[model samples]
Target: MKKDIQIPEVSNVYVSVVNEYNDIYKTHDWNAYIINDKDVALEMVLIVTRGFSEIKSTSTMRHKLDMLPAKSYAKIEFMQEDVLALNNEFKVTFFEANKMFEKTYLFRKNTINKKALQTIPLMEVRGVLVK
Candidate 1:
């Protein structure tokens, strides 16, 4: 016999798994929002996407060091506000699935194009998916 687990309804939520390096793994984009004056940080509706690689996290933190063997996948939820915040603060956001985040760094106001948003690549990402 096989067990049937019901995946939560996340039509309006965006989810991305981050590794120990803070890289983004698999990500799902949805039409979600954060209600005003809500105790809950944000309400996310999970959206469905095809051809997404499902990965897991395989890293640990001990004392002040993080031992990460390789890049894996995990489930993560990102609110709309979080996305806006990342865009505003960091100027560049990661849209790749199952990529190590450690190799990516966000520069606030440091780049050749200081007027526009710039991203410094520490590592090559597998790919980036939007929507």
Candidate 2:
């Protein structure tokens, strides 16, 4: 019976971290975003995120969106400077066409930095992308 269960593959959805400038604070900060590149809208979008290291772990954060329109993106959260030292993980789950799909995107410790910036899909700025 275990073999009979089929898990759907996730595609066209991505988690990206972009370094953005805060005009009000005159500072640069990193922010996480969820990109939905599918042709159809996703329903009941949910994302659980956290950062961890061998010696310590951050608290889990949960975010939900009733719908994520096709070919769009949403900001998940702001990343503090300290969290960059830890492995960051984002678990995304949503439904499309009555089928459930889930995917985990991870940025390994110290992987998110200026040198890794690149043009990301659906977002105008350059940032680090985890597939």
Candidate 3:
């Protein structure tokens, strides 16, 4: 009976981290974004994120969106410099084609740095992407 469960595989969706300039704060900040590259829209999008290490962890954060259109992206949250040393994880769940799908993206500890950045999909800026 348990084998009957089927969770659709999530594709063309990604979570990325970007170091961007904050005009109000006059500082460079690390921000998280969710990118949907598919031709179809995603509904009931939800994201839960957290940072953790072997002995330390940050609070869990939950974010929601009514819909995420195709070929678009949305900012999830900002990360302080201190959390860069911990493993950051983003769990994304959404409904597409009348089915529910989920995927988890991770930025390993110390990996979200300028050296690891590349042109993020569907966005003009360069950033570290989890695919």
Q: Which ranges in model 3 have alpha carbons more than 4 Å from their true place?
A: none
Candidate 3 per-residue C-alpha lDDT over 1-131 given as tens digits, one digit per residue, 9 for 90 to 100: 88998998888999999999999999999999999999999999999999999999999999999999999999999999999999999999999988999999999999999999899988999999999
Model 1's number of clashes is 15
lDDT of 3 at 5: 81
What lDDT does the true structure give each of the candidates? 0.22, 0.95, 0.96
Candidates ranked, most accurate by TM-score first:
3, 2, 1
Clashes of 3: 0
Q: What is the TM-score of each candidate against the true structure?
A: 0.17, 0.96, 0.98
Compared with the true structure, what per-residue lDDT tens digits does model 1 show for residues 84-127?
32221111112123221211112121121213322212222221
- In terms of lDDT, model 2 sits at 0.95
Error of 2 at 95 (Å): 0.5
Candidate 3 deviation (Cα RMSD): 0.7
